[model samples]
Target: MSQLILHHYPRSPFSEKVRTLLGFKGLRWTSVIIPAIMPKPDVIALTGGYRKTPLLQIGADIYCDTALIADVLERLAPTPTLYPAESAGLARIQAQWADSTLFWTAIAYSFQPAGLQSIFGNLPPEHLKAFMADRAAFRANAPRMRVPEAIGALRLYLEQLEAQLADDRPWLLGKATSLADFSVYHPLWYIRQAAGVAGILESYPHLTAWMERVQALGHGTSEKMESGEAVALAASSTPVSTEGEAFLDLHGLARGERVTVAATDYGVDPVEGALVLSRPNELAVRRVDARAGEVVVHFPRLGFQVQKVE
Candidate 1:
């Protein structure tokens, strides 16, 4: 297998989620630090405009969305399963909730005045403005939760998690950490990133302890590579050697057909190219970005739609 390449910037909470998972799995991966905002040429080269951070790349296969990225990593390294056999279903559902709901709440609550100041404290005003614009674009059409409401919900969720750990449970599940752990970890990691506002966790000792345990799992072995280098890697490499037999055919499309793939919400730029791989879980469009050259833009089937643009 080619090295697991991750395209991410340091401060992304979603990227943190995948990094901790990689550490837990003890996998070695290449790190490609992408721009934190728009004009992600190299990333667009591979993902066809699904500009979410922390995209996982294996060989030439690209996996978007942290939810799907988690599953892909689990498949790559299964020993310390993210999905435990006993309550895998429940764990996954809960993790999804934590990742989506709890995550947004924490962001809303933590990025309040002081938190935002702490985060962009030193960066130039223009950079901060650009960051805000980029994030605003990302959340453009999505409904936003009120700050107070988000804080209340997050507090309740944290309380529930605190109770879960009160029993001296080594993991969120029975004895070992699973998807629930990583799901819960990312948001708190974001809170921690807020520096000043992170003190909110002081009240939840158990949650803080769990955070330490997970954070200890440093992002699996990674070495930095330039964005151009990563692009060249993609251009020179052949597509992932998949059997291509597990395709589920959600769209009335076939491999090798020309199609367009884009995110359901943000970063709406559609990348049209030969639909190279439409496997059970993902869609890949082989397209050329003038800046990044030939690349395969990819996305998970969930939260993304595919069509044969006429």
Candidate 2:
């Protein structure tokens, strides 16, 4: 098997989730740090136009979105299972809520004045301006929750988590950690990174203690690899064959059709390719670039849309 390559930067919350998961799985991976904002040329080479951070690459297969990435990681390393057999359904449901609702509320709250200052204080003014412009463009089509509203929602969510942890189980679902714990940990980790807002966790002692337990997981063993090296690796490899899985054909689109797959929410840019694999819950499109050669870009069907190209 080829080395696991993760394209991410340190500050990304979703990346942190995957990193911790890697630690929990006890896997060694290659790190390819990408820019915090746009103009991610190397990433574009691998993913076409889907420029979200923290892509997982194995051979010529690229997995977009943390949700799909988590699935792929679990498939690669099954033990210390992310989706325990007993609570798989419940764990997935909770994970979805944490990744979407809790995540956005935390983002809104973390972008408050003091948090923003803490994030950009040492950076040059131009960098900050560029970051703001990049994010504004990223969120152009998405509805943003106001900070005040987000604060109230965040507090309510934290109180609920405190209650869940009140029994001292050491994990959200039970004694063993599951997908829900990691999904929920990243946003809180982001909030903790900001100087002024970290005190928000102090109010919930049990929740804070649980957060510490999750934080101790630490990112797994990683060796640095250049973006160019990662692209070259993809260029030289073939995507894993998806030959046996039955195609559900929800869109009346057949395999080998030219199509575009894109996230329905923020980061709405699409990737155009030949549809290679489609299941009820997942999609993969094969695209080729001069730098990255042939690669299969995969996305979760939950928050994304797939359309045949005209």
Candidate 3:
């Protein structure tokens, strides 16, 4: 198997999620740091237009969304599984909630004026302005939770998490660290990084201790590689064969038809390609980039919309 290549910037919350997954799985991967904001030409070349951070690249396959990436990593390294069989369904449900509802709430609270200053304090004035503009554009058409509401909800969520851990179990879903742990960890990780804001966690000691355990996992073996090299690697390799998996289309689109797969929420940029595989929970589209040649881009069925191209 080709090296697992991750394109991410350091400060991205989702990137931290995958990075911790890599650590938890004890997998070796190549790191390709990308720009925190837009004009990400290399990423666009690989993903068509799905500009979300921490894209997982394996040979000629690009995996978007950390939810899908978690599945891919589970397939790659199954021993210390993210989804334990007995608790998989429950774990997934909790993770989905954490990734969406809890995530937005934490973001809203973490970007309060003081937290915002803490985040952009060291950056150049122009860079800070650009970052704000870029984020505003990203949030366009998306409903934002106001800071006051987010603060109330975030406190309630943390209190609940603290209660869950009060029983003295090592992890959220019991003895093992599951997908729920990682999903919940990233948002709080962001909040913890912001000055003054992390004090909120002080009220929940159990949650804070659990977070330390998750943080201690650290990013596993990773060596930096240039973006051009990763692109060349994709150009030179063939996508993993999908010969035997039967296409199961929930949408009316058929295999070999031109289609576009996009996230239903924010970061809704579409990736247009030939629909190669559609399962109950996965969708894959094969597209060819001039630099990367043929590559298969994968997205989870949840949180994404598939449409046939006219």
Candidate 4:
């Protein structure tokens, strides 16, 4: 089996989600910390243009989104499953809500004046300016939640979660921790990063305890890997074959055709390649990077759009 190589930064909440999953599965992985903002030449060389943080790479196969990356991890270590049978469907639905609605709300709430200080207070002015501009571009065309709206929604959401965790239940889905816990944990975790806005979470005792439990999972065993080394690893390795796998094509595009895949929400920069795998759940493209060699980049079909290059 190819070693799990994660390209992520320390402050990325999605990266934390994957890290905790790795810890839960007790899987050791190679870690490559990429820049929080843009101009990621090495990342672009492998992903083509999908610049989302915390991509999972197994040899030449690069998984773009965390949703797909979670599936890949679950497949790799199935014992501590992300989707317990009892709460599989509900967990997926709740996770989707947390990743989208809850996440955006937390962003609006945590990036306010005082919260901004907590995040960019110590950084150089240029660094803060650059990060702001990079994120502005990233959030283009996505629905935004203003701080006022985010505060109200956050309070309501936290209250609901506190109620859910009532009676000292161990995990979100009864006995075992599922994707819902990780997904919900990350957005609120982001909220906690800003000490100013973080106090909102203190109002909910049960929710706080749940957050502590999730944090206790901790990141699993990992070793540092340089960016060039990660790219070189991709250059030398081979993408696992996806042949004979179920192909569920929603778009008219067929396998082997030139196509571009991009996120439907934010980070809309398209990754161009030959359509390699089109399934009900995933879309992959075969692209050859001069630096990274032949590589297949994969994305989840849910939030990504696939367009055949005319």
Clashes of each: 5, 0, 0, 0
Per-residue alpha-carbon lDDT of model 3 for 1-310, expressed as tens digits?
4699999998899999999999999999999999999999899999999998889999999999999999999988997999988789989999999999999898999899888887778999999999988888877788899989999999899999999999998999999899999999999999977876778889998999999999899899989999989999999999988778899968777788999999988888989999998878788999999999999999999999989999
Which has the higher TM-score value, candidate number 1 or candidate number 4? Answer: 4
Query: Which stretches in model 2 have alpha-carbon errors above 4 Å?
Result: none
- Model 3 reaches what TM-score against the true structure? 0.98
True-vs-predicted CA distance for residue 253, candidate 1, Å = 2.9
lDDT of 4 at 89: 95
Looking at model 2, the pairs that clash are: none
Give the TM-score (vs. native) of candidate 1.
Answer: 0.92
Model 1 lDDT tens row, 1-310: 4688898988899889888988999988999899999887778777666787888876556677887788777777778888878979888888878877888899998878888988889999999999998888888787788778977887898898899899988778868788888888999889988887778788988878888888898887888888778777766766655354465676777777888777775666676888777776677777665555566666777667778967
Show the colliding residue pairs in model 4.
none
Model 3: lDDT equals 0.92
Give the lowest summed-lDDT range of ten residues in model 1. Answer: 239-248
**lDDT string, candidate 2, 1-310, tens digits:** 4699999999899999999999998999999999999999999999999988889999899999998888988888988899987778888999999999999999999999899887678889999999999999988778899999999999999999999999988899987789999999999999987777778889999999998898898888999999999999999999999888788798989999999998998898999999989887789999989999999999999999999999
Return the clash pairs for model 1, or none. 46-296, 46-297, 47-297, 47-298, 48-297
Query: What lDDT does model 2 reach?
Result: 0.92
lDDT of each: 0.80, 0.92, 0.92, 0.90
Give the residue spans of candidate 1 off by over 4 A. 242-244, 288-295
